[model samples]
Target: MLHVAPSPAVAGNRHRRQMLLPWLDAEGQRRIRESTVLISRVGGLGGPLAQSLAVAGVGRIVLFHEGALLDEDLHRMVLMHPERVGEPRGSQAAETLRRLGGPHLEVHGFDHRITEDEATRWMREADIAVGAAPTYEERLLLNDAALAAGKPFVDAAMYDDETHVLCVDAGKSGCLRCLVPEPPPWRADFPVLAAVSAMVGNLAASLALRILAGAGPIPWGELVHFDAARIELTRVRVPRSAGCPACAAAERTSR
Candidate 1:
């Protein structure tokens, strides 16, 4: 329930606190309301994550996906309509995000995978980034972007009924490069299920928003694994890897 501007809306400030009344103070909410985040692949995980962020009053959101909708993807890609089976996914998600956000929400839709150049370009404008892509190549790109930008990046993943989340708050929290020293090969489609997708995606948004609002310290350098089927929820600590490839370049640059 974001309040619309009374009249002239000021730049760098708008109706950002209208929806964050539940857990965020006006100041925290305003910080989020003024920040921007770039989310890759608005598919299964990214769709819900983006929806939650938009609904939570994020000031701006940019999403990228380089594919057309397919029938099989609809089970997880909630923002797409059955009729939009052949339309571009990024375009569809951009429209849906606009509807979910208040008038001040800025939306950028890119129908292409993120490259180093493009990633750096968007990363400069965004405060944080979310990696919901199914492929590790894309995830690696995001990790590099996060490392390059010195910003928070949430690595989200799911397998069957299990979901895992890792937050990377630069300089303070460990990054993806620090946790997984090597990028794992991706399956054509990852082991994602509806239940786990929702859990992981929502958790990603919650964690990202908490960081964005400066509400609490994020679970950086730590991993949270939840499996409802086995009734197992645990946190594992991962130390910074000495030979992480994606981030090694940056570590050397700073020295």
Candidate 2:
């Protein structure tokens, strides 16, 4: 079970500044404090996403990332400390989030490859799910799990000189597979910069926050892409695929 604060008003005043925003009043803050988020892989993208969610005062964060810290990971993963290079990434990320999130926030870390079974179980409990795994296999699993659980899914990926953010409302909007039916034949290892990944992570976090707080339209079927080299931002409409296997299976089961 995820531990959360009793109320935003009594949560050590960490959210005082954010509470001032019109959309994020006391009620909104309380909503944020009561929500639980699941992030897969606290690496390039998930690291910054988790940080922003923590600062925004999310109630609980369940992180799943299996691996030891690598020298390359240190470049973009802000939560991984320099001294803990040889340690487990998931444990380190959970520890850092707990420290930064303070008494009101609860963080759980699991250092294991997330199987389809595990994804389904955890996504059932998560208010929102984030896909930041290095591989497309994990990303697809997260998307399907979120669809089954009827939760919003946010995914971000970085290429050599560009990054993309996809937000889906499950049944109502197109999902990852809908956007890209199959994983493209890309290199297993890709190039990325800390700044670009952080930017994408922050964007994903913002969308998740809006969904949790009911502050604005959640960008249900939108894809936001940024060109790191040229500094360009573009938005595209993400149409739901009528024949999406994951979604179609759910629709059939519901019927």
Candidate 3:
């Protein structure tokens, strides 16, 4: 069953956007057509990222966000138009994405919070997960889900002018656990401008497709940071810790 625009209740046409998404070869496109990604929220960074993923032709995108759209969110998550201001965020994003793309893309909007169990379930169905949530609480839950489900993940964050996309391999590549041994610095209002969010989020979506299609020499488990304010780009090694919780946990369970 395919996902369509305006998100009709019926399953969409399977071969709708066969011509677009030319980044991959025939085989790569074929793989994308068969893949599924579960994005936690379709707000802020996740909005454009999910849209690009749909445009790039991910088979299905299961979106989970619990609230309705607020007038304030229209600033950065521009997909939510004034008309859909009061609708469920996930529904609005799904509708907009479907309309922008086509039925070949599948967008499932869940009106529930992404709890631990829910995250794991979504990760189970996803080839890779993208964590663009604004909080470390969400990131940690995402990490556990990816690790337990053995799915690769891409963690992206934006703070005003600076943004980064960190690719995670659960137990293989340095997961988020490697970078921060303790809780991430909690920011009540993460300083992310729309421009910076769009830049980094799109990169995350781009890298997600590359990982899925096995395209070129993949830059897996690397931290790509961009300071849009300064027009700078930095590639840093994804740090791994000897006592990282996820890695140590995986090893302990394996042993």
Candidate 4:
């Protein structure tokens, strides 16, 4: 169903040959190359997540985030540069990914926050939607859009030394709204360490690749939590909410 032409340079496949071994075959790699991913935010969690997908040869990536780069952002945002502090974070992240991912990778950077209309349109274009926004409102908006479009949504979050990642398969798994129910009290400035965020981001990226490439079974509807201080990883299944308006709408559309 997905078709992607190889780059003119032989180096494209050659560049990713290391991953083509025991697990991912040539066909699997092609699937990954043809898929498009939508990542919300280029902050700590989303930055490394997008970078991992780009390096793994995901063909197209759409990034949505608002505001200019702050000097404080550099503490955890790996894709940002100190010189581009006043510039838009989304555009800067796109530039960084382009340089790291080479010529064949297509990266679209929106320097503003995504509106409801934009979310609907972009989710339709994305094979998978990743939410790493700092706010629950943005994450829930993305979740609704992804469910409406019947696309898989990956949610990544970090608070202090704790990291959480969840994958939602529309019509098959519990959605973000089901997990959070209502937005909890959250601060704009949350404590996070670079290493902790990157670890969680990479974990989210791995899960996305598995879904896109059909490389392995994905733990859909399960929330994965990692505590850096405790040095432990745990998984718990999340139940679909019967009263979730977003999920209810998605269900109605599917019928």
- Measured against the true structure, the TM-scores of the candidates, in listed sequence, are 0.87, 0.92, 0.86, 0.93
Query: Candidate 1 has what TM-score?
Result: 0.87
Cα deviation at 149, candidate 4, in Å, is 0.6
Which ranges of candidate 4 are over 4 A from the true structure? 1-10
lDDT at 179, model 2: 86
lDDT score, residue 156, model 4? 92
lDDT of 3: 0.76
lDDT of 4 by residue, 67-178 (tens): 9898988999999889888888888888888777666778888889988998899887889999989899899999999998888899999998898999998877898899
For model 4, where is the 10-residue window of minimal lDDT?
A: 1-10
lDDT for position 107 in model 3: 74
* Candidate 2: worst-modelled 10 consecutive residues by lDDT: 1-10
- In model 2, the runs with Cα more than 4 Å from the true position are 1-10, 249-255
Candidate 3 per-residue C-alpha lDDT over 1-255 given as tens digits, one digit per residue, 9 for 90 to 100: 123433334334443464355656778877886798877776778889988888776878887776778888888996677777787776777777777656566777776568888887777688888887877778767876787777778888888888988888767778776876557656567666787798888988988888888775555677888889799999888767787777765555345
Model 4, residue pairs in steric clash: none
Instruction: Give the best candidate by lDDT.
Output: 4
List the RMSD of every prediction in angstroms: 4.5, 2.6, 3.9, 3.5
Ranking by TM-score: 4, 2, 1, 3
Candidate 2 lDDT tens digits, 1-255: 223333233456788987888778888888888898988888888899999998898988998889889888888999988898877888888888877887778888887778888888887789989998878888988988888877788998888778888888878888889888888777657888888888888988888898899888676778888898998999899888988987775465455
